[model samples]
Target: MKVGVVDYDAGNLKSVQTALAYLGADQFVSADPEELLSADRLVFPGVGDASSAMRVLRSRGLDAVIREFVSRGDPVLGICLGSQIVLERSEEGNVDCLGIVPGASVRFPKERGLKVPHMGWNQVSYQAGHSLFRGIPQGTSFYFVHSYYTQPLRADLVLCESEYGEKFCCGLIAGNLAATQFHPEKSGEYGLKLLSNFLYWDPERNL
Candidate 1:
């Protein structure tokens, strides 16, 4: 199956591409709208500041293309900054986002002794039966590195939660769209399992 990674000029595309290659899936990385829209599935991964990322996507006319792609009912997985971008808005730069997932991205408070960026590995707890977490044991740890967290407005869409200073949504699933605030590509075996599930996930069947 054709799998495409949305380049948008702000993601760890190489790492994601490498993971897909390891999974033996046909994959390509691109910023071109037609290239991405033609893929069987898409991975919208990103890192770096929200406002600037949005600027890059807008400049490339990818913002509209992504929405159109999703409207067609294909699967799109977002990771880290990519996940946050799919939300309604982000407080990071007071920026508006894709709104595919109903939510807002908010910065972690500067509580004393608590680090701004919640980096490193953390366990995720999700209810069973979701394709993305299928066969993956509970409390599986995934790597994370970010100063902001997604607070999905539709709380039922949350697949898992992780704690830093407090609990926050770590994964989200809604029909053909799925996203995670952690970098599954950097999470080792657990990460690989998640990616594999995503590779074969059937949104319609799951529905």
Candidate 2:
């Protein structure tokens, strides 16, 4: 299926594109509103600061475009900072997000005694499995490098949670949209499998 990797100034577009290519997806790098709307699936992959990313999004009117696509029932997958963009708001810089899901992004609490970045490979315990998680071996470890985490207000939206000093939402799904705080590209075979599942999954039939 055709996948549109949103080409934003703050996102890691190339890395994402490489993984999608490996997954054998029909891929295109675009920030064009029409291209995004026409995409079979959309992936927002980003690194770096939240506020700055939002600024770049707002400057080019991507925020409105993304919100529009979500409204139209497009399947979306956001990674890392990209996932934060889907939250209602972020405490990172009091920045507003796409608001496609009910949640607030917050920085990792220092009191937890965990490293701020939470880098390295960590075991991802799957709370539940669906087409998106198909082929993922049990107790799979994925790469994560982020300080902020999303706390979705809707418990039902949370598909999985990962432990880092405490349990936090690592993966969340709402309707046709899915997002992960961890970078699937950096996550090796399991991560690549996740992308492949997204590539073939049909949200309507529940795959």
Model 1 TM-score relative to the real fold:
0.96
**Model 2 lDDT tens row, 67-177:** 776777777888889888788999999998878899899999888677889998887766465778888866688899999998999888886778899888888888788
Local distance difference test, per candidate? 0.88, 0.83
lDDT of 2 at 200: 78
Can you list the residue pairs that collide in candidate 2? none
Which residue window of length 10 is worst by lDDT in model 1?
Answer: 127-136
Structural similarity to truth (TM-score) of each candidate: 0.96, 0.94
Model 1 residue pairs with clashes: none
